[model samples]
Target: MLTIEQATYDAIVAHAKRDHPDEACGIVAGPEGSDRPERFVEMVNAAGSPTFYEFDSTDLLHLYQEMDRADEEPVVIYHSHTATEAYPSRTDIGLAMEPNAHYVLVSTREHGNNDGPVEFRSYRIVEGEVTEEPVSVVDAFPR
Candidate 1:
């Protein structure tokens, strides 16, 4: 299961809704080897396509460098589906490079930019295999 803070979850949903019609993509970074997702970093969708999303090469490089300096690693890699369910596509499966990261998919098809709830799902993709995981939202992380 992927446990996340309520505020972080809300922010991700907001970002997805804000980028409706174009898939939104970003990541949450935490200390290396730690599964905690404590920092949210919103990223631009280089592809800017409703059916696809990509991070700008330079931006991706910079993000990795910055994370390295902070001794952080991406704990969550997320994207939104504008027209489909919150499930990984073949393309997504092929692009799963972080075996230890939680892959989050949010579908804005049902609600679009409305106030209605979206379909939020998480999965673990490793070596072309996708395994669904449960999500737990909490007020905050315990020390």
Candidate 2:
């Protein structure tokens, strides 16, 4: 199962809410350990609609450089689903680059109306094949 901290989950939800009516994409950065996954918002260029999502290479390059400087690699890649369910679309499978990296999806269907309750899930895309896994969001900070 994929694990995430409260902050990371909050960030992703905020990003998805910010990009409502369209898809938002980003990357999750963290150490190899499973303590706290530091998720970052990479630029996502909408395919002129909510049905499609394309990562902005220009922004991705900047993120890559930042990660390189930090001596860290991308642990997971994230994108939001505006209209459809939080499942891997055909295009998502086609654009799978790192099979090892977790593919995170935020579902804004019926739930995420406006700052709504969003569902988070993780997936693995290898060799044009999609394998989904469960995600558990643990609150890093106990109240």
Q: What lDDT, from 0 to 1, does candidate 1 have?
A: 0.97
Superposition error at 24 for model 2 (Å)? 0.8
* CA RMSD of each candidate after superposition: 0.6, 2.7
lDDT per residue as tens, model 1, 1-143: 99999999999999999999899999999999989999999999999899999999999999999999999999999999999999999999999999999999999999898899999999999999999999999999998
Q: Which candidate is the best by TM-score?
A: 1
- Predicted candidate 2 versus true structure: per-residue lDDT over 66-136, tens digit per residue: 87787667777888898788898888988888766889998887655485588788988899888889878
Q: How close is candidate 2 to the true structure, as a TM-score?
A: 0.86
TM-score against truth, every candidate: 0.99, 0.86
Worst 10 residues of 1 by lDDT: 110-119
Q: In model 2, what lDDT does residue 73 have?
A: 70
| Error in Å for residue 17 of model 1 | 0.3
